[model samples]
Target: MSDAVQTLTIVIPLQVKPRGGRKAMVRPGVLALERRQDVTLIKAVARAFRWRRMLESGRFATINELAAAEKINASYVSRVLRLTLLAPDIVEAILDGRQAPGLDLPRLLAGFPLAWEKQRASLSPA
Candidate 1:
């Protein structure tokens, strides 16, 4: 054999982005290999609507009572209840696993514009 050496190199194009308070590697024009659905966000949104319906139906006299029934903190329940005010399209995107990459439960729960139009604008990925 000749006293020669050969080298091979490989490169991957990826971007680091913040996803739900965590950093994740993202490749351009590539779909995730696994489910993109955010289970925590979906669960929170579902709970918000369910709580809203319960309150509307007089099933719960107050948030505190609802919180007690759910065994969740009252403050947490209140924060989650705000999800009921999200724009319908946003909710649909979330449920469909097509929400903006940056959108997450913490961002949603932290609060968003009350106006639907503003919400869409504000919640979009930068």
Candidate 2:
């Protein structure tokens, strides 16, 4: 036998389903699993709050201040403080020394005007 030729055909059907209001809005269980792998907005904010409080309380002033007091880099302290602008839960975890490693605090804070506004509004009583 020299050369051989063969032909193959495949058919696939695709179906699209229209969501029915609120039922469609509900996320599947996989979403919960995914969420567990990441830090939520609340956690970020908490971390920021804790850092801000620490700085405000004169606990850590300059880079040298943090280094002398906590034996860490001044730059690292500054970087961590920026997380206070994030959601509270994040800040809390950091303060508690259990935040997820390498979380991008600044990126998390970006475009979160509503979160900031809500916190600010709450501070001002009706």
TM-score of every candidate relative to the true structure: 0.72, 0.35
lDDT of 2 by residue, 1-126 (tens): 858797799754433334434323333453434343444544545554666677688887755775567676666556555555545544454444444544445543443333756643432223
Q: Which 10 successive residues of model 2 have the least lDDT summed?
A: 17-26
Indicate which candidate wins on TM-score: 1
lDDT score at residue 27, model 2, on the 0-100 scale: 38
Task: Give the number of colliding residue pairs in candidate 1.
Answer: 0
lDDT of 1 by residue, 11-77 (tens): 9998787777998898965445225778999999999999999999999999999999989899999
Candidate 1 off by > 4 Å: 1-34
Worst 10 residues of 1 by lDDT: 28-37
Q: Report, for all candidates in order, the number of backbone clashes.
A: 0, 19
Query: How many Å off is the CA of 28 in candidate 1?
Result: 18
Candidate 2 segments exceeding 4 Å error: 1-48, 87-126
In terms of lDDT, model 1 sits at 0.88
